[model samples]
Target: MLSIIVALLVNLLIETSVSFSVVVPGDPVVAHVGSTVILPCWINPPENAEALEIRWYRKEFSNTFLHYKPGKVPDMPVEPYRNRTSLTPRSDQSGGLKDGDVSLRLEKLRVQDEGSFRCYVSGESSYDSEEVDLKVTALGSTPVLFLKFLDDGRVNISCKSSGWHPKPSVTWMSDERRVLHPGGVFYSREAHEMFSVHSWTAVSRSDAQLVSCSLSLKTGELKDGRMDIQGIVSSDSSGPWKALFFTLFIFALLGFGLVGFFLYKCRPGKKPDKEIVGDVNIEEPRKHAVEITVDREHLHPDLMVTKNCKIMRDGPGYDHTGEGFPYELCAFGAQRFTSGRHYWEVKLTQENTPPKNYWLIGVVKHGNFTVRDRSALTPSSGYWFLCSDGPNGFHTNTDPPVKLSLTPRPERLGVLLDYEEGQLSFYNIKESKHLLTISTRFSGTVVPLFNPGAGDQSPLIILDCTKPVKSAEESSQPLLSNNSSNA
Candidate 1:
């Protein structure tokens, strides 16, 4: 007749210094009120089950209390366990039925325990072993934090305490040990492998000369760590402010002198101080063409038509293109030529028809002309363009050098000979603006004319073309296109 037993589920074991084992009945059991408890138990093979005997006991006056055999413990109380103890088997859970887990349990444990208890589960002629110990915790106190600075201007605050089942955490107070508004504080734990309690703090100096570090720990214990930290309190070095001050002082003196001079000259009572106008600040040297000797008596008819004479077929040297229209000025005649002033006439026509295209000339940067868009003019200091003669002058004709001319007249345009800038432009003298500029070569060889008829077609013509340079002011503007060289 198999019986079933059931009782406390908490297991207790016999404790050795390093390990504990489940108590088998009949063994002396020792227990500490606040220490852990373990129940010794193990599994028995089905064939080994019947012979087992399990018992529960206590050492009040030193003796066994109850005996467990199969489904029931015998009818004896053994005194100390008269009502305080009971041992029963679980049919549903015999000792180690699954894998030799003969687990047992205990209740209302007290200290002063110092012996082995047992659950004797004997197999049909043998038994196996399993056990556990019961331990109680009495953590009784909280941890605290302390603050201090090291000798080398470092912080040496520490946190510590005892009376904890596991250590407790201690964090530094902000206001000298009390909580304060925005005091940056740090934390660390108690120095224990149990990971119980901890404490921490941040140490900083009173001024910019101070260095700070944060202590982190679980036990809030003390240990040496790198003093190096993240927050920077101050800098140790100074800069060159003194040098800069001296330099600026000298500059102020010079500026003061100038201001004083101005105030004295233009005082309210002084009728706006005045001085004779100085020479004009011209970009180029003034000296206009002093004197000019015409190579031919009769100029190119084309030069006469629009009065764009005062020119020569430039370049046969450093002139590269052998092309540019090198206009020479009749410093005196330029002003009157456009207004239709009369001039003495000499004659010398080209020995042969001076070709269809030749240079026509006009003043560029002076007289009636000026470099309106600096981008269109080179900054060669002495550089200038020939103003335009009328278009009909040299662009087209039966005899270009003769059909249209550059001598005298009003509009702007003339045979494009060559130039330094990439493209050459023709201007309308009468209209006072650029007519158009031509690109790409019209013909290979350009001819010259000593004197050609005037008043037929274009005026100022470019002989060789080169890229135009942008003046400082023009360079600041946005570019139009990659190919565009001038405004």
Candidate 2:
């Protein structure tokens, strides 16, 4: 009887030790907004967890995000995590549950997703819980600088950017490195829970030289944009030139030959007609055709790009594992533009396919292609795109996505970039219909980007359009006019 009692006690001790020892990651898990991250939890000593119950919930609110049992299907997640959360096994073999892995996978991480989570496991007579902290980070767009002449004679220097979480800070400084306070600031929250900020500082003519604008996050990410105010000559400095031009104009008007010349130059009904082609009315300043090829080095892992960098398709073996984070099936063009006007086209090659379920075409700052977060693909992040998704339809990838009404989607799309004018326009090449235009000051070199969403086997083919040639008379004309008024 004594030996039997001793053996029973030993068996109970071993079973208790094996069932109740739960382990979780000691350090906090860090992830970016719109990214998927894993919160690791497992049974110590590697005992099978297939028959146990696992629950992951917010430590503060006790709101469950995931709950799983061995034999029955997991319970429906709460409102916030309806379809965006999942459980991952610890081992690739035995389906992970048998290996005691109970890690929780969170998809499309949001700003509110940052906090402590509790992983609770329970068995017949053993129960244990561990806490895991999740931290979500948001990276906003590159700062853009704008200089506008105010009606009161002060120069309004403004900076704007979008696509940030946990709103960031904006600062303006003069060439002397003195901080300038903003006269006004504006912030807007986007559909994806990101932020856009526009801040302006009014400065006197004397202080217009080199002004800088910076955007920063608490995580230490910073982007700066600077403008040379000297290039924007003050209205006061051009007063003498304007007066001289006025006197010369008065003298010239006194001559009969000058009067005839002026009448010819200013003919009321003789305005030059702009060129119109197909369905497009070409009102642009100068159209220069550019050849663009894909940049394979920056392409996402799930994209299969052709050697010539003209075609792209989804990788056959790419898997999403059902997590709802936006998959990055994008590639960047090799060409970079900083000045002048350029036009390029992309044609969809697949036939008999419903309009692509997802597609994106736009320009991004040279290095921004590597950012995996979808929020980083906003205008504020140095990215401007026209995107079409199955649910969202067609829209400009702005802070507040601007929905487009495109009838008979064009298979061929045209992109026009006017660097000097701070304009990016899109057109339906096949239909010759104008789609949309984005106006924003660009601070640095930008490259073309294409994201043919996952599973989209259709290729995006780059087309070669003929460049417009200028006639000898048009080419010889002075590009700048000395008689232009400064005001």
Best by TM-score: 2
lDDT of 2 by residue, 282-360 (tens): 3342257788887666667676665556666666667855343343777788899889888887776455565565678
Error of 1 at 227 (Å): 18
Tens-place lDDT per residue, model 1, 1-487, is: 1222222222222111122233343443444234434454544223333335655444332354555566664667655446545432434545443344444445444432334554445544344443333333224223333344456764444333322332232333343334312233322222121222323444555521222222333434332222222123232123266446434433322233344344445557665432111122111111211222232222321122212233333211212232332232112222221121111111111223222233333222222121122222321111223322234344311110113233333222322223332233333332332333333222121222222223212222221112222223122223212111221
Q: lDDT of each structure?
A: 0.31, 0.71
For residue 155, what is the lDDT in candidate 1? Answer: 46
Q: Which stretches of candidate 1 lie over 4 Å from their true place?
A: 1-40, 47-51, 56-66, 70-101, 108-119, 127-142, 148-158, 165-487
Model 1 residue 101 lDDT? 45
Worst 10 residues of 1 by lDDT: 280-289
| Candidate 2 stretches greater than 4 Å from native | 1-28, 44-46, 59-65, 72-83, 89-99, 150-154, 175-177, 234-271, 274-487
